[model samples]
Each structure stands twice: as structure tokens, then as C-alpha cells.
Target chain A: MKNLALSLLALLTLAALLLGVAGCAKEAKEEKRSESKTATETPPVKKETIILATTTSTKDTGLLDVLIPAFEKETGIKVKTVAVGTGEAIKMGERGEADVLLVHAKKTEEKFMAGGYGETRRAVMHNDFVLVGPSSDPAGVKGLKSANEAFQKIADSASNFASRNDESGTHKKEFGIWEALIIKPEGGWYIKTGSGMAATLRVANEKQAYTLTDRGTWLVQKPNLQLELMVEKDKPLSNPYSVITLNPAKFENSRVKFEAGKRFADWIVSADAQKMINDFGKDKYPEPLFTGDSTLTTSK
Target chain B: MDLIYLGFKQAFIMIFKGDRLVFEIALRSLIVSGTAVAISMIIGISLGLTIALARFPGRRVLLSLVNTGMGLPPTAVGLFVALLLARRGLFGFAELLYTKQAMIVAQTVIATPIVAGLTVAAVQNLNPKLRLQSLALGATRAQMLWTLIKEAKLPMLAAVMAGFGGVISEVGAVMMVGGNVTGDTQVLTTAVVEYVGKGNFPVAIALSLILLTLIFLVNFVLTQVQQRETSSWPKRISK
Candidate 1:
């Protein structure tokens, strides 16, 4: 009888803990809803958080660390940033899961806009992709003027190439170059890491193979890697990053903060933001990780 | 706190709505971990039995190794498997990287040691005289071993439960090896990570709750088997 009572008491304790958690969650939700409601009535009734979905390169390069805190201080809007691959970030925008998106894949961004998922799209920054490989340079792709040519050389020599097959923006760019070269990269030479740019670079470094990575991620990871830049100055390697606001009308049920998202889209291309972009990586890297969108700046 | 509540609420809704993605991820999680536990049981039980019954050289060293393996970090196991299956690694020619099979392989690696160590403990706890008695009753060596295993059935069942729990709740190895490909290699744990990374806390929470429920359900069934006719509740309540 005593044992049964003890077991029942334990069960009751577990139930109470569960209830306590649920009750706390309910209170937190109520407080947030009320805060947001009052935020519109007063200048500073409560803090507001906006979701920003962006590519990993920006975060990995430590650019967002500088930009986010600055933006928050000026606007009093807390930015909750989600750093993922550009392809996945764009998909989040399409689903209205994010308030704003900062991504590099132009084709997919256009497709997202064409689908009526985005309210506005603005060019924010630009970077370029560079081919990096082991210092040994077994493929002999150094001094190649065209990325396609470098890709072809690697294929012809059957040199190992670590491809980030995770459908990221860099992966898409790599696929485009392969398509243009008409080289069916397969067999033992072509390896898919299915990972982020940094991880793929590490895999390439480990295997002493070649891989294409964004200049931003490459520069940040350069200090740790044994690989060196082997191919650059290619027209097809230019990568442009843009910011888009998800259309609230397209996803009525989603928690899309249209006003806050639009404000962020405008703030990102402003002179202050542009200057921040230009100054980023000046001290650490030999060259800035990203160049401000000059045409957009001039028009602004 | 709200996220927790939202997670529970959303989990219930998703389950009732029969969300296709949720169902797919749940099914994949069960299949992958189930397959891994099955493989672990086969190798773990047999190896454990051998180590427990035999008086061979380095037996203590082997037992210590199994004990060390029981605590092997899942992420380390993931890295080891990743290196082995990498394109430049020895088994790279098979191209098993980033597939469900790779996830199974990693989980099996993580689970086998746990099962084996527990099985060794379970079998070792049995009376030594039982083996002699069975042998004296004209039982063959294999039959004696089988009879010994049956006597330790409860702990053997516990071994199965522990192995299943270890693999089912593991996320790092699966994420590293499976690539978390949507509609392909994605499991409940990896899906939760992906959703949380995307800032969909509600969905992440929901997936987490489902994962917890799954682990609970599997263990509940095993507990039933382990406690069969031994539960004190009925007698205590009747009194």
C-alpha cells in the first residue's frame, strides 16, 4: 500500500511539472501578444523582434554581428537572424516563414518574386566566388582566367573535387559552371559533401582537392585551411546578394511583419548600411568580403 | 515558455491533421533507428555472449573496451563514420555518404557497444550453477547457452530498450551523415534541428514532442514485457 502511494505521488509530481511548463508558456505568449498590440499605440511600449533569414556566408564572415547590433541600436527593433544556405533561406521567404531574406541566389530570388511571395526586392551587396585547392595544385588550375576552364581542367585530370551538393547558392553556381562546360562530372573524382561552404572547404582541404567557395567564407576560413586560391577573376563567379520582404498577402496565416520587414529592406541599402558593408573585413582581410551595391547606392 | 506550449499544441494539431511531412519524418525516424537497433542486437548479443562465456586472454581488456564504447559520443562516432565513408577514405568507392544507410551505420556504431555492454552485464549476473545444471541434463553447449539467456530475459529486454533509446534520440550523427535531405533522409530529430535553425520554434517544438512521445511509447511496450505479471499495482490497489 505504501509503495503504491509512493508511485502515485511520483506520477503526480511529474504531472505538476508538465503543467507548470505549459502554464508558463501560455503566460509568455499572452505577454508577447499584448506587447505587440501596445507597440503600435506608443513609441516604446515594448520591444519588437523581426525575423531575418539570410545565407550562412554573411554570418560566417561575421558581417551580421556588426550590422545587426548597429541596426538594432538605431531602430530599436531586435533582429532575430536565421543563417542558412541561400536556397533554404529563399524557400523560407517563399513560405512566409521569415519577415525578410538576405540571400545570394538571383535566379531563385526572381522565381520567388515571380511567384508573388515577396513584396519588394533590392540589391544590397555583391561578392565573388573563388576556386581554392591544395597548395600542391595537382589539377594545375592555377592562372586559369575562366572558372569553367578551371572546372574542365579538374575534370580532365580526374583530380578530386569536393562539391557542396547541399543546393546552397555556391552549389548552384558550381552546377551552372558545370552545365556550361558540358562536362558530366561523375565517378570517383566528383565527391559531394552535402554540407555548408566552410565544411566543404574543410573536406577539400582534407582530401587535397579543389572546391568553389564564396570569397567571404574563404577569407574567414583561410587562416585555418592549408588550401590556397587557385582560380579567380572570372565573370561567372560574381555573386550578388539581395534583400526581399515576404508578401503578407500571400500568407495570411503566417506571422509576417510587413511594416517592419519593409523598414529593414530600406535600412539595409541606406548610406550607413552601405558604408558598413564597404568597411566590413577591412582590418582582418586584405580585401573587403563584400562590396556595396554601387548602382543602388547611387540611385538612393 | 510560450514556445513549449505552442510546440505541444502544434504537435497535437499536426498529428490530428495528418501532416504529410510530419508522418514521413516520423516513419523515416522509426525505420532508420529500428533497423540500426536490429543490427546492433544481432552483433551485440552474439559478441556479448562470447565475451561473457569465454575465459580467453585479454578478456578484461575487451570488457573495458566495451564499457568505454558504451559512452562514445554520438558526434565523434559521426565524424569517424564520415571520414571512413568520405570519397578519399577506404570505403569511399561504395559512395555510401549522405544516405540513410550512412545514418544507420553511424547509429549502429553508437548503439552496438551499449547493447553489448549491457548484455554482458545481464548474462554475467546469472547463476554460474545454472550452466552446469543444464549441461548435466544432457543439454548441448548451444542449448545451455540458450537456457542461460532465457534466465536473464528481463535484462536482455532492458538491453534492447537501452539500445533503441540510444539510437532513436541521437541527432548529431544522423544530421552529419544523412544530410537531413527533405523527404529523403530526414528524421524527426534532424527535422527538429532544421526547423529550429529556420526559427520555426513551434514546428521544432512539435517535432520534439513527437520524438519524446515516440521514445516513451517504445519504452512503455518494453516495460510491459519486462514487468509482465510482476507489476505491484494490481495487488496494492486490491489490498
Candidate 2:
């Protein structure tokens, strides 16, 4: 009876191992089926999957969520977006991994274009950065016409200011403002948080300190934060986002995805999508926050 | 492909340069997994040995529950722990989420069951006659228990080693709980993920190579120790 029991247990263990192998095989078969279906359906027309590297602001702003679905519905081209910092996004494009990039760093984007890695950097949307701090405005530098002047006062007062130092588009803009104010913000009060926009804002909120944030992210986070807009409409505060497709002439693989990238880009600059961006922050906040370019609609 | 060669070259250069970031990541991974293994072994071995040696009415049910936990996914454990530790969750006041301590806790939860389950199986696999013989030799109950523990040491060591390996390779649990904060919580596996996401194939490849090497060394050392213990225990038991 003991021998029989041992034999049965051995057989059961062997059967379990076989079942595990079968499960793996089943998953592989399903993957193949999906791949073949896509290939066969687009026999005549080339169906390409484009990798779009864009900023988190675009996603946090709900711009890409609205625009990507519409673009996919209209063109039947699938766009897989990898949301990252503009620095990381540009690096992806440089590595020939991303077919197109929708980023906001003008200087960096221009360098990429000049380096021959990208082509046709088109301006897609514009939102200004704002100085947000505790509603108490501890520095008492609110209503400043110049963004630099507000920054100067904050520095002079040794008030706490959170800076995103992750080489992100927002970080770049923050540094530019600090440079224009001619102040090297290196003291204890000037917190150089090498983190994402969301995290930096969270830090600012926690410390009840000052921070510069894009209008979209700020609008989304406004309900939760005790911070208020301290400065806006300054020329230095203008944050223009752009979209650039990889230079297909250099990378042949990106050429196949060019059509998909162009379709997504076209949808971003479209009137309907622009309207959505314009009306994104109206309900709870009551401020439009961003103005869509009406000139594109008029030109069309 | 050309991409493969480029990735390989970049990985090679990064390793040769002794990149501070890569070293820091590797060190964190080791520390996290080591702490997890240490905690799990203590809890698993004590509970497993007690259950193995004891006779209780609900012992079978308790064993079944541990077996169920053995198959729990890292992500599920991570999410459960996250919910418990998140600001809105049960222990929200503790503010443990997104901290190294939280990662260690999640890993411990994941690995303890694996160690315990394996340990129970290991202890049970021992010959019943050995314990009977020890008792017949005028040994006290405590002495007999120590003999059984000594006999099962090899399997327990092997079980602990295997559990350590499982925790170290995991990314999801660590990422969710630790937040993969650069210079703070960024581990080797999560760094690989971030690099891959950024399309930085070279850094990803280099990290992966290092991960592979580390896993191989751990497995090699563990297998050797396990083999030595298993071989020597049987001889000692027979004598």
C-alpha cells in the first residue's frame, strides 16, 4: 500500500509539471494569433505601431487621453505613448526607439533638430507657468508683472522655493527664470528636488513653500493644494509644447511609423482637440487656464 | 541585430567605467533582498519547525493555508501591502509606503510562505525511524526535537536560499512599495525598467547583465551549501 501511494504521488507531480508547460504554450499561441490577425487585416495597407514619447504634463493635462483615442478612431493607426520627461523623451528619439516625440523643451528640441535626429518641430499648445505658493503668500510677492522679479523677491526674502531639478522641461524653465533673476538659489530655503513635476508639487504642498508649475498640472492638483497662483501672464512664463517626428531618412524603421506619427500630430493641432485643451480646466476651477491657438482654425 | 550589438557595447563600457549609479543600484538590490531573506528565515523556520514537530487538530488546515500563500504573486502582495500602508489605507498613519522599510516588509510577506512551505516539506521528508531511534536511545523529548531539527537543517537552508533568490529578482513589488526613487529607492531591477522605458538599451542591458551575474552567483553558492549540508546530515544521522 505504501509503494502504491508513492507511485501515485510521483505520477501526480509529473502531471503538474506537464500542465505548467502546456499553460506556457497556450500563451505563446495566443500571442501568435494576435500578431497574425493584425498582419492579415492590413495586407494591402501597411499598419504600423508608432512609439510616441511625450511629457507627463500632456497625460496629466488629459490632452493625449482625448487626442489619442480620436486619432486612432479616425486613422486606424495605433499609437503607443511612453510618457516621460522631455529629456528622457529626446534620449529615446536619439536612440531610434521612438518614432515621434511630443515634448516642451524648445532649446533641447532645437538642438535635437539641428543634430539631424528629428524634423519639423511644430508648436502644438501653449500654457504659461505660474508661481504657486501658500495662499498666505509668505514672501508677499504676489501680483508681480515679471516672473523674474517675483523670483528675486522670494530669493531675497530667503523664502522656501521648490525647484524640479530632474532635467525636465519644467526644470529647465525654472532654471531659466532663476538665471534671469540673476540669483544663484543655493541656500537651504531653495530646495532643488531632483524629481518629477507631480512629486515636486507634492513637496511644495507639504512644505507650504513656493513652486513653479505648468498651468495644466496645477489646475488638476488645485483642489487638493492650499497653494494659490502668485504670478502669471509674464512673457517668461509662456510654456509652448511641440511635436517632432524622427528623421525617417536616417532610421528606416521610423519611416514605416511616420504615417501614424503624422496622423497623431495632425490630430493634436486639430480644432476639436484644441477646443478640448481650451475647456479642460473650466468646471471646478472656473478659469480657462490655457488658450487654444485660434489662428490654426482661421488658417484652415 | 545592430541594436543588440550597440546595447552590448554600451553595457560593456558602463561596467568598465564602474558607474556609481549602477553600483548604488546593485548595492540596494542586495540590501533589500538580504534583509527580506533574513526576516523570512527567522519567521518561516520557527513557525515551520514548530508546526512540523507539533500535533494539533487544525495542523493540516494551517499547512494548507501556507501552501496557498506560496503561490501568491509578488504584485498582489505588493498591492495588498500598499493598500495597508497608503495614506488612505488602514495603517495610513504609519506612512510606511514608498519607503525601503515597506519594500522589505512586502518582500518578507512574499518570501516567508515560500520558505515555510519548503521547510515543512523538507522536515516531513526526513525518515520517521530517525526520531524514533533517538527517543529509544534514552533521549529526552527536547533532545529528540533537537536531533530532528539538526537532521532537517540541510533542507531548511536550501529552502531559505531559494526564497532569497525569488525575492531578489522581483520588480513589481519593489517598484510599487519603494516608488523606485532615484538615489533613494532605485534598485537594479527597477532601474532596468526605467532604462528600458526611456529606450536607453545600453543601460538596461548593462543592468540586466549585472542582474544575471548576481543571480548566478547566489544560486551557485546556495546550491553548494545545500548540497554539503544534505550530504553530511545523512551520514551524521546514520552514525
Candidate 3:
């Protein structure tokens, strides 16, 4: 009998948590308000759904795991999230396949907007990428101030540099550093994983190699990875995330949920959601995963 | 490995705790793969029977195509479907991209050829004289086809199991179309991918274990049905 009772309690708690994943959880306060509203002669309400295409770093840090639910509970809008490489996320937005995008490729996002794909673009958060390497520091590039110099050091040393090579934001940033140094970076020393951040980190961990990763994901996976933050706080390493809504008028006859997407875009920058973003990961990790700053850091 | 041990620990904990997330993903996996296998069985078995029992001009070409589909890479198929269902694609008006229905469509495309190609082998392996004997015994064309199918029942069951296994274990195509969008389209396979992305190998392994147990239990049941004895077990034991 005691076992049954405990199991039931566990079940009820799990059911509540499950609601967050389904993106339909509502606060108790809203239920009463909804009940009062329904007492009057009212028409049916269409619950809007939007597909938010975002990058793997933001998604893997488990930021949206909490923020999306909070946003959904407040607005009663259902959000379906898809995490891909930043390039893929931007491409999806360009094709009107995604209603809204939360991505970190600043130059690409600007190009997308100039191409008339975005109705509105707002900076949501800021973080920085760090060059992480095995504690052994095979390349002896630790504590480097400039990302370019670090890349050059690693290349000249012929150190194994694990690459994501999947066109992710991190990959592009790493490539940009190499391009700045006029290095093509094709050799046996460069290992391409063509995977997400964590997988590349694992390869780096196993091989004692070096790779670039956003701080948010790096912090979250610190306990499991053997890599150390080698070069950080570089001007070229700052990552700025933006929320861009599709030009609904451009996809007038398409499946773009303009109003709901706009709500998410406008509200994410609001005081409430910004606070949620700012406070995320502070309790678990040493510091918050991201800063809710819209100033748009001047970095690559 | 420590990772494997931790995964076992997590799986046991999640199971005993009645983790609704695990149950939700397991259930969705079953539903998506189950529906796809059933639909493919219908279409594939019919096509298999038609090609095996009749003669046609392009029958050789069709057979080769089915055989090719059985060996086709799933990720390639996923890309094809993604393009077809993209907002700017030919069927963009339906807006089925990134939905569960779209996953079913892709899996069906993946499983159909396996079912049809195997069914062709199953039918061809039977004695050609059986059809003649059924007709000689005055069985109607439909009735003869039914007998022919009944004779190939065991192998056809194998085909169904293969189709289900292929679709459920697949991650590339489902991720391509369904987008692994949390509770809506996430199945056990894609859930593992998500956890692995977080560097949570324990949880990822736990999800993979759950998926494996799911596939094992399904195959177990199908095997039971496939290998059931005609005589009562007690009678056979006495014999």
C-alpha cells in the first residue's frame, strides 16, 4: 500500500513535468481567469503554434527547456522547437519553413534580413565562445588573448584540432579565425566530426585535441568533458543570439504563424523573459549561461 | 564502461519513478512505427502479390526498383522527403513539414520496399503448382491468392517485423521531417540523440536501452505468433 502511494505521487509529479515538454502547461492562476472568461458569451479561441528553429548550442545548454515553458504558460501559445546548426536554422527561416529563429550567426542573420526574409530581428542574449583543449595543452596555446594567434599557434604546432565541420555557428567562427590568419586548415591534424558541440567535445576529450565551443554549452558539460578553457574572452569569440520572425506578409499563404511568432519575438526581449534568460544556469553552473543583453556585442 | 553502467542506473531510476517523458516517447515511437508498418504491409503485400502472380511489361524494372529501395540509405530518403515537403516544395500547401504525419510518410516510404521485396521472395519460394492445384480444386482467383498468401504467412510476418524494426530504429529521416520537436515528434530514437547532444551519456544510453527493450519485446511477440504450433501444447507434449 505504501509503495502504491509513493508511485502515485511520483506519477503526479512526472505528469506535471511532462506538461512542460508538451509546451502546453498553464499556471493555476490562468485557469481561474479562463474559467471566468468562459462564463460569458464567448467565441472559441484558436491556440496558436509556432515552430522555433534554433542552434544546437542554445538548445543543448537546456535554456529553452525552461524558458519556452515559461513563455507558453504566460501567453498560452504552443511552441515547437527544432535545434540544428545555425546555418540550417537560418536556411529554414529563409525558406519560410520556420516561423521564428533563435540563432547566433550575426552576419548571416543580417544577410537574411537584407534578403527580406525577416519581419523583425531583436537581440536576445549574449555569450562568448572559448577555445577548449585537453589539459595537457598539446599546442601550448593556453591563455592566448587573441583567437587568431591561438589558431596560428595550434596550426604551427601541428596539433590535433577537432572540428565540427557541420556549418554550425561555432564552426563558422573557427573558420573565420583561420581565414583571418590566411590558413586553409586541411591536414591530418584537423579532425572533422560533423556533429554537435557535445560530440565534438567528446572527440576532443578522447583525442586530447582542441576545439572551439560556446561558453554556455561548455559550462553545462564541464563535469563530463576533460577539456579546459584554453583561450577565452577574445574579442572575436563573443556570440550574440537574436530572435527573428519570418516576414509573414512575404509568406502570406504559407504556414508561418505570424502573430504568435511576433509575440515570442516581442516578449523574449521583454523584462520578464529577459530576466528568465539572465537567471538561467546560475544555480547549477558557476555562472549564468547567457546575459540577457540586447546591445549586440561587437565581435565576429 | 562507466557510461554504460550509469545509463543502466538512469534507466532503472526512470522506470521505477514512472517517468512520463520516457513513457511518452516510447508510446509515440510505437504509434509512429506501428502505423507506418501497417500501411506499408497493405501496400507492399498487394504490390508483391500482383507482381509475383502476374506478368507485366515493366515487372522486371519494378522488381529491381523494389530491391534497390530495400538497400537505400535512410538519410538520403529523408532529404528527398524534406525537399518535397518544404514550404517551397511541390506539396508546400499542405504544411506537413516538421509534423508527426510527415514522419509517418517518410517511414512508410522507407519500409514499403522492404516489405514488398521480401514478400516477392516469400511468394516465389512457394511451389508454383500450389496455385495450379488451388485452381484445379475450383478455387476462385481471389480465393487462390488468399491461399497463396496464407502459405507465405510466416515469411510475411518476418517482413512486418523487419519493417517495424527499420522504421523504429531510424533517427535520420524522423529527425529530418519531425525535427525532434520535444514532446510532439520526439520518439525514443531521437530522444537519445537529444540527450547525447547535452553530453548526458547516461540518459542517452538509458533512452537507447529503453528503445532496444521496446524493439525486443515487439519482436518477441511477433516471434511467438509466427512460430505458434498448430496442435495444442498439451497434446504435443503427450506425443
Tens digits of lDDT, candidate 3, A1-300: 323333533453354346433433333456556545544533223466688999998889999998897776667667889899999999988778888999988888889888888888888899999999988887888888888888999999989999999988888888888998999998899999999998898899898899999999899888887789999998999998988988866776777778888888877888888898999988998888999975552221
Pairs in clash, predicted candidate 1? A25-B1, A25-B2
Better of 2 and 3 by lDDT: 3
Model 3: residue B225 alpha-carbon error in angstroms: 7.6
Q: Which stretches of candidate 2 lie over 4 Å from their true place?
A: A1-45, A252-256, A281-284, A294-300, B1-239
Clash count, one per candidate: 2, 0, 0
lDDT of each: 0.79, 0.75, 0.83
Q: Best by lDDT, which number?
A: 3
Tell me how each candidate scores on DockQ against the true complex. Answer: 0.03, 0.03, 0.27
| Ranking of predictions according to lDDT | 3, 1, 2
Give the TM-score comparing model 2 with the true structure, all chains together: 0.54
Where in model 3 is the C-alpha error above 4 Å? Answer: A1-46, A248-253, A295-300, B218-239
The list of candidate 1 runs beyond 4 A from truth reads: A1-46, A294-300, B1-239
Models 1 onward score TM values of: 0.53, 0.54, 0.87
Model with the higher DockQ, candidate 1 or 3 = 3
> Native-contact fraction for each model?
0.00, 0.00, 0.56
iRMS of candidate 1, Å: 14.9
Chain B: TM-scores of all predictions: 0.91, 0.91, 0.90
Question: Least lDDT summed over 10 consecutive residues: which range in candidate 2 chain A?
Answer: A1-10
